[model samples]
Target: MIVAVRRSLRRALLVAGRDLTVERRQPDGLVAALTFTVTLIFVESLAVGPVEARRPVIAAALFWIALLFAAILGATRSLERELEDDALDGILLLAGGRDALFAGKTLALAATLGIVALAGGSLALVLFDLTVALPFHLVLGVALGVIALPPVVVLDTLLALRLRARALLVPILALPVLVPQLVAATQGTAAALSGDAAASLGWSGMLLAFAIAYTGIGLTIVPAAIE
Candidate 1:
């Protein structure tokens, strides 16, 4: 049992490392995503204007909107990397099978999205000139949301690969799966910033549940789907 687990871990890390290395070598995709996210936040801040009375919810929504779109774009590019040069086929032939590839890709996707979320969130704060009562809680909410999103993003992208209008369908399929996450995140951030600790706790619990459920589904089915 130990041997099997160790082998799996090793192969998964190899897959993730390779992907990260490729990303390091060619960073245009990351740059594009960051640029798009920053531009979106800038435009939103201008529209909302600098006002002391601006609602925390508005800031939360704007932050998440940019995070959401940037995440989708990033996830698409992540999958495309595997498809290019038939790299995925070679990956699948590695010792741990499809599960290894899925595991590594999921980790890479989650990490990449997490970094983007942090950067975007920071830029949103600066753009909106916002202050919150519980900044740490807001971050936790975003972290959970990011954790939950990449699995669905990976699965749905795979499903959409065969579709004719994949670009539209990716968001269409993903948005509904993402609703619970977005709602929980938005509510949690608003509640935290408003100093409603009780409300924030409730939303955080929901966000954690959504993360666990989606992650389980992804790990269970993604490898099978790939085959």
Candidate 2:
């Protein structure tokens, strides 16, 4: 069992590395995600008006909203590219199993969305003049949120691609599942900015739990889902 797990992890890393290399070479998904996220953050801040925008709670909420949607965009593009010329089928056949494929895709999506999160957070800080009273908590919240996003996105992306109206269905399917993580990350960021250490920790823990739960679900279901 241990050997099997190690082999899976190794294959997962190779898959992730391959995806990342493709992204680095083409960069369509990353560029689009970054642009969309930054634009959404700026527009959301404007919509909330200057006074409300400066509030840590408001800023955090807006940032999270933008980041989540950007995650969807990134995940979709990554998966869609694999659909070209039946590349995904070939990858799945060689990936050892669906679990490894899922893990690899999840990791790749996480890495991509991590960049979006960082960019959005930095923009929030600048636009709102946000001060982090507990930098540790803020960082932890962001890190956990990044870790939590990918499994859900990757699963939904795969499911959506199986359908005809995938473009419209991805957000519809993903949004409801993403709400808990969104709420946790937002509240955690707000808490960190407000110096509420306990609240930040609690929310961060929630994000971590969400990550683990969704990842497990993805691994369990992916084999059947992909077929």
Query: What is candidate 2's lDDT per residue for 133-203, written digit by digit as tens?
Result: 99989999999999898999889988777677888899999999999999999999999999999999999
Top lDDT model: 2
Candidate 2 residue spans exceeding 4 A from truth: none
For residues 1-227, write the lDDT of model 1, one tens digit per residue.
99988887787787778777877898765777788888887888778776732578888877777777777787777777777787778876765567777667767777777878878888877677677788777777778777767777777876676566877889999988888778788888888887888888888888788767776786687667774
- All candidates: CA RMSD in angstroms? 2.2, 1.0
lDDT for 188 in candidate 1 is 86
Model 2 scores a TM of 0.97
Task: State the weakest 10-residue window (summed lDDT) of model 1.
Answer: 45-54
